[model samples]
Target: MHELTNETQGARYSPTSIRATWDGTGSVKDASRALGFSRAKGYDLVRRGEFPCRVLRIGRSTRVVTASLLRVLESGEPEYSGGHTGHCTS
Candidate 1:
């Protein structure tokens, strides 16, 4: 499992790890975990259209795009930055 860095309070998911672990898409919960957030929060973000990555709605299930997630992880910026600088302040 990946751990959150104390300095950023964010979990870092390498492209290799993501590619190896997921196929084309993954659950919002998993994406949230990779982004260092809770499952509930992930759902909330999806509902609010503010998740860091592209989301696909298939019937009643929601899937986060693996490639989008990887891009966000690599860029360290959510789809909605909301003035956030992708840094944690002490």
Candidate 2:
């Protein structure tokens, strides 16, 4: 999933609204913006392979899996386990 940040060079968006929105795929910048991280940091995470989700590369474009991100945020755990392990009150 993609994390959104303030530095993304695109339309303005609120964090909560973006988090609640899902489209299955997003660019690197879009993910960074959603996660509130700098574009530079987002790329850095990609380079270090520390990002919690997988990134899909098609040609020169990179996209984050929105479902995985939403799952992690909603459950506070990775998405590979088939079910969320964390509890959400809301």
Candidate 3:
């Protein structure tokens, strides 16, 4: 997980860029960046239980399962499918 610096606020947040390979875990923003998902839309998908990748919550932190993400990206189907569209969101 890479920590991206916000120049406007000098704040740091995790957002996995495309250049960075999936490493089993990352923030929602990270997955968002990987899939070109807007921040709001990414969280919305999570809240709706329809995100393309698996979301893991630990306390206040949210993690996207890299393996699951990769599966979806490679196959357009979530590993734990249960009525999800399995469509890649651009």
* Candidate No. with top lDDT: 1
What is the alpha-carbon lDDT for the whole of candidate 2?
Answer: 0.59
**Local lDDT at 35 for model 3:** 65
Worst 10 residues of 1 by lDDT: 81-90
- Per-residue lDDT tens digits for candidate 2, residues 3-89, read 444334333434354556656776767667656577888788767655555566667786777765665555656443213345231
Per residue, candidate 1 scores C-alpha lDDT tens digits across 1-90 of 234355333323456777887999999988898888899999998887688888778778989889888888889977642234652323
Q: 13-90, model 3: which lDDT tens digit per residue?
A: 223333264467867886766565687888888877778877777777878887777667667665532244764433
Best-to-worst lDDT order: 1, 3, 2
Root-mean-square deviation of candidate 1: 9.4
> What would the TM-scores of all predictions be?
0.72, 0.57, 0.61
Better of 2 and 3 by lDDT: 3
Residue 76, model 2: Cα distance from true site in angstroms: 3.0
How many clashes does each candidate structure show, in the order listed? 0, 14, 1
Higher-lDDT candidate among 1 and 2? 1
lDDT of each: 0.76, 0.59, 0.63
TM-score-based ranking, best first? 1, 3, 2
**Candidate 3 lDDT:** 0.63
